[model samples]
Target: MRKIPRWLARAPIPVFRLGIGGLLTKRLVMIEHRGRTSGLIREVVLETIKIDGDDVYVISGYGWSSQWLRNVKADPRVRMWSGWGRGVGALATILPRAEGLAVLDDYRTRHPGTVRALATGLEIEGFTVDGPLPEDITERMPLVRIRPRR
Candidate 1:
């Protein structure tokens, strides 16, 4: 797939926020987080890997350097809107390497095509559709676990 420009990457966010994307809520979610420096509310659309009980798992395709990840790391409090429901106060936690790998493995098993396509699009070296996930890919793309606060 061709690379999307920064503006194009976020083009669908408006539709998602308006709840039109709720049809894809099973796979997509809108994350609302505060900016680390500016402290302004920012939103991003992300693909959901899995939802186990109260925890929602997602991957950072851009890895640790992602702005949203940085903001979540600084403040775990966040809001999430998805097909399942809306979470006003969610806690975002960066999962450990082992847990992240497990999540990735499950995702790959469930959505082999998407995994392969993402790997190819991200230029993750050594990632094959049927092969094991490359170590470098894990390091570059971390999984985050989100739990709605009760």
Candidate 2:
């Protein structure tokens, strides 16, 4: 799979921020978090893997190196907008590797096409649309579970 350039990947951020993201809410979500160093609000759009009750799950294709992931780690407080609903106060938690793997397994079964695209975009090797993900791939991708603060 071809990887999108960083600039190209960020091009739709504004649209996502302006509530247009609601249209793609089933597959995409808008996250508003504070920059760890700058302490300024920053927003990023990411693919939503699953939603259980109030817990929303997303995978970091760029892993821990992702700036948004790092910011969320520094401060879990955030705002999330998705098709189901929008929350002004949410908490972001990095799931353990095992839990992340479980989520990946379920996501793969539920959204094979999207999972395949994600694997290709992230350049994860040994990924197949019909099989379980390898340990290496799971280890490289971190899963984030976000829920309303209340």
The TM-score values for the models, in the order shown, are: 0.87, 0.84
* Full-model lDDT for every candidate: 0.80, 0.79
lDDT of 1 by residue, 1-150 (tens): 234487866876777666677676568777899999999998987889899986889888877768999899898899987774344579999888888878888888888898788778877665565767776666778788989889
lDDT of 1 at 4: 48
What's the lDDT for candidate 1?
0.80
Q: In candidate 1, what residue range of length 10 has the lowest lDDT sum?
A: 80-89
- Judge candidate 1 at residue 18 and give its lDDT: 69
Give the local distance difference test score of model 2: 0.79
In model 2, residue pairs whose N, Cα or C atoms come closer than 3 Å (at least 3 residues apart or on different chains), thus clashing, are none
**CA shift at 21, candidate 1, in angstroms?**
3.1
